[model samples]
Target: MALAQFAREYRTVRRAEGWGSLDGAYYRHLPFQDLTGRFTDIWRIRARSYHTFLHRVLAPLESLTGRPLNVVDLGAGSGWLGYRLARRGHWVAAVDLLDDVLDGLGAVRHYATPVRPLLAEFDHLPMPTGHLDLAVFNASFHYSTDYAKTLCETLRVLRKQGTLVILDSPMYRGPTSGMRMVQERQARFLAKYGFASDALPSEHFLTPARLDVLSTELGIAWRLHRPGLDWRSSLIRAIGGIRARREPAQFPVIVGTCPS
Candidate 1:
């Protein structure tokens, strides 16, 4: 009940931000989807990052086997990545709280592949124990109000030595910087939308210390890989650092292995 309520509010904020575009076909194409309007550059960046995720993470893992993988996509907005996996013959469960046709799990119908859509919370995944080979929080982990609880729940469903991925979440060098980013974001949303857009008690960012704690508690070893940003983004971040005199948040593809 709480999950559904939080997701509906999140959807409202996303709609206000223009991400809930009515074009369902656009989202079905996913990382291969074309860009439009004010969010063009942002979508382009996301596409590039997703390709990096594919190259540095998925491709290599896929190469390791010829058989289909048992995979789960947590917070699978629009079911794009899940569709991609399902098309490749992997057994996939696409989980999310939103089932809206335009921008949520219901958009999975736009894809031809048979992706199993499950409307559920990430922390309390409706999956069998020790059955999944891969569990990916695609651009979604930072939305968790409790990272430890979420990961623990994920760990319970993962097979021994199964991999879990944290993709596209903003990771700062420290908690202070992360908090600043969160505050700034909240302020912008509050001013622009008459509310902070924090409909849930999400952590909203990540730090090394936080990751370290997860590693310790989950008994998992994490490998961090920072895929390169575009030259313009690189320059902009550099300029912003010079002016703001602070470290920019990074999107590192963080992969953690479940204990054997």
Candidate 2:
């Protein structure tokens, strides 16, 4: 059943290029437009669930790390999470590939905390080494074409004992399922954009075994957390039982810590 749904989603993505091009050509021209609206509408339920989960994750971490910690929100879309962290008294650097998207966040006017917006890619962050206390990839890490290199780059920017948190992305129980997602994503990108199958951005999902290997190779301590849904998610899960049951391991928050 999970495989069937996966196949169906692959076909759906193959059939249409729903948003602007990957390079932000379409959105860059429309400075005043709310480009994130369509994306938020599509992933409305998941987004809400992630938002709740983030708050849950942050509460404890905030207490552990103390206030005014330096944070980097990698792949920050509209800078929502960054803004939230900043508002909680943390200094946040919101980084994304699309400058227009960052500009659209209106962080200066909307957020009370200092939110520094940066236009950069995952593998090539323009940040000083060992400076950040936390680096968050909220539903954004899989966009990297080279996950290993990206992780290494993340390590370079994080201070000793800093945390890397990955949330809201599909995580597989094993390699086979993870590779299946990667193949389907590649096929969809190839069909939709006429690009090489390997060229797709933000399509890879992680498996626990693979993550273990990464943690070992990078010398970082890691742990995985299964996020419990709030009432809203519980109700949605009840109505979408079959869909929810299809992949129990799909969404989880994986944390990696830089060893002191």
Candidate 3:
């Protein structure tokens, strides 16, 4: 099993670096149907902490709304989070770039409240204006090339006072640190893959200053929350024993509410 997993990772690396025909498609199509069980196992490990964090964030929103939420899960990947939310009786729309990935979720078979899997991009969500009670970008917001445009679109689709949550994505203290991290990631990718950095999807970390500007421009009140380290994360940190220099806050949950 270990050998097979190593082989799979090697192949994925090759694909990501453009050395193989897959050309980063393997990573892009993650959390897909995994009859072999390997993908699911990996996802379980990575997502466990995220799931707990998400539930904590959702609890207050659920209580405040006092009814099933009209929730849109932007960049929802395999839609597991949407499946869970749907099972809890919220009306969930799981939007992603890949239709096949969404279809594999089997939301209808698994949940009573069917999860609507929509193929769409973050900047141009195909939903009615002022309809969504909540919009969540779980580790997906950074993929946007234009963060401001995406935030504006998110606000447009949200109802008055609707909540927008950005979870499990990196946040920097300032623009300088954020740009430095971006360049470092690009450099690492180039070194490993021997391809143009753009071969992999573009991603940019958000900074508090940038968010503040966006919030003021859009007239939305926002707050940033750094998650407390859970057992899983703690164990990972202990094993790794810290890396190079990093911003004060890494993974953050940015919550914004559209003004009435």
Candidate 4:
């Protein structure tokens, strides 16, 4: 058997026995029938964490843009951040793979329109060229099976001098050592299409080091800002006026700018 096939079988058997932390829910339901409810349930579980990330990350961009900005929440799961940003008076677009999932987010004030499904593959997203001012990947970058293609597609839709931000996503490693399971599953999913896993480097997923090099190669200026696990993000709704933490720690936001 091929390595990807082997990995898939191993993951299936492992998960059937409840061995890994990787949730098998998507393995069954995803890229299939409507999955709105499942997406909503998962996002609700992480609402607080999302709130913190949105506040810290969007706060500064809001200032830099000097007005309510044109923002796209790429891979926007359940539309939480888009909803929050729209409420704050920004023109937000919540794009996702499944139309039903985007529909599930419900009414969002100040948004340009109802949630729109991109429907295109992540690596080949179908947004118009040079339109969005800010694009965000909030803990959802891992789903793109082709990281480089996805990044290129993301950059394609960004306006000159625009910003692309990724937050709260680990390069690898997940709850219960799920990286191995993730690797196994993706390999299996891609094998039938005649695409071998070895065609690209496994390191395409964004890492701090990789992001640095990608920015330079792509001629984009970038910064690594971690709000120290406690720094209050200005992107949030400004709770109790809490002050940013003083200690240095790994925070979430990795902001980069497209050259004008």
Candidate 5:
């Protein structure tokens, strides 16, 4: 029953956002998305973030461990990131609540390499203890109803020395700015779709203090790695902040590892 409601809300937002044109090929070339398509420019910025994950986190882990890491991509919409990871020879579990062929677990079939698809929630992953070397919340952690549980659950499946990553989630310096961004987003959604799209409980955006708290509570150390921002991105952010009357959010790849 809950899954049905969640699917309905997910479909409503996807249709309202006009993502019908995003097919398998579109997901295939993510980060390097279509130049003329909607949200291409946003994905342009996200490419830097993804590269940061590659250079700063994944590369180092690979060099240190000297083997293909077992990875789980949480909230793997369309399984693009997982497909990419699997193509790199790492085993990947593409997990999401949505099973829609184009934007969900079912989309894993589009890729040539093998990727395990699982329909599961963040708070209760279907993986065995100490089974994975890395767990990544691919633009998905902020949507967690309870981040503490979600993080703990993810860590549960991972070996004690395993790493966890939060990729491409809008993060702010403080709660106030994050809340303001949420208000503006909700207003836009209400105006456009006659709904706030907050039907489900979610943390929405993250803050450093929040991560610090999570770190202390969960016995993990987290580092915020900011992807390089170009001049145009800074200028746009400045203008957008003035127009929105609140500070703009930044997407940083937050990486963490627990002690053995």
Candidate 6:
């Protein structure tokens, strides 16, 4: 079945079986690191540094939409991306499964208006049609139980020519026993619930091939950047430089727009 159709079907079935409740509890119950704020700080620092070296690669989008951008950050834990986009005068909304993450980001101040957080499932976005200029998935796509469905809904709600930027770690197989065990565990959960398609860690991470599939399905053009070692080191060196770009970066950001 097509991804959108499958997602609608799965969501219906899951909702009927009370499976949606499990995701809410699972994300909410995770043991956050003691230095919770630090993680967000690190993410911001790295992201800014990457922009320094690769801004050339990413800057075109800014010009494409000359006016203030309306952005939505999905899985916006701590609102790092939302805060940054808002700082650049973008009207931003930060969405997440857990309310605590939204509460914690309340302290974040940006140039644009303070963000509004919406609590909703990935498969079921809480927005109207043609509402957003951009939607971002930052390092959290893999955690999505129904990524295909989520992707379709994201496209449905986006305005014609609106962009969807997914930043995620690529999927990989592991050699270590512990890693294999984790993979097995992930597989079991997915099979039991029909929640995911692949067992690789980055199953939700769109590879070039997968990107092609999504592009065709959603009718969006896609571009990818794989950061290099020097780019990665430079980003780490400067933390949050005013303007920078890097290769060999921590994660890849997939940027594409819906067809007009």
The alpha-carbon RMSD values of the candidates against the true structure, listed in the order shown, are: 2.0, 7.9, 7.9, 10.9, 1.7, 10.7
Instruction: For candidate 6, give the lDDT.
Output: 0.55
lDDT of 1 by residue, 20-63 (tens): 45665676656755544646656666777777777887777788
**Candidate 5 wrongly placed segments (more than 4 Å):** 1-4, 20-23
Candidate 4 per-residue C-alpha lDDT over 1-260 given as tens digits, one digit per residue, 9 for 90 to 100: 34344334433443343321122332223223223353432333244445555566577777777788778887664455676666677777776543332232222222343444343345666678987888887566655665556777888989888888876554422222234434554676456433334432333245556566677668778766544322333323133112221211123566778787
Alpha carbon RMSD to native, model 2: 7.9
Candidate 5 vs candidate 6, TM-score winner: 5
Error of 5 at 136 (Å): 0.7
Off by over 4 Å in 6: 1-58, 101-113, 172-204, 231-250
Off by over 4 Å in 2: 1-56, 102-113, 189-197, 200-203, 229-249
For candidate 1, the lDDT comes to 0.82
Top candidate (lDDT):
5
Best by TM-score: 5
Model 1 Cα RMSD, 1 decimal: 2.0
Better of 1 and 4 by lDDT: 1
* Tens-digit lDDT string for candidate 5 (1-260): 65566567778888666562345577778766753387765777878888999999999998999999899999998787888888888999999998887667777777788889999888888889999999999988988878888888988999988999999898988999899988888898788877777777788999989998998899889888999978887788788988988888889999999767
Backbone clashes in model 5: 0
Candidate 2 on 1-260: residue-level lDDT in tens? 43234334433453353543343433332222335455433254445545554665667778887667788988776566677677678889988755432233333334455689886778899999999988999667876766778889998999988888887677767656566556664675667655434524544778777787887788878776665666766666455434434333356777888778
Which has the higher lDDT value, candidate number 2 or candidate number 6?
2
Clashing pairs in 4: 55-235, 55-236, 56-233, 59-234, 59-235
> What's the C-alpha lDDT at position 216 in model 6?
80
> What's the TM-score of each model vs. the native?
0.92, 0.70, 0.73, 0.57, 0.94, 0.60
The order of the candidates by lDDT, greatest first, is 5, 1, 3, 2, 6, 4
lDDT per model vs. reference? 0.82, 0.65, 0.66, 0.54, 0.84, 0.55
Give the range of the ten consecutive residues with the poorest summed lDDT in model 6: 26-35
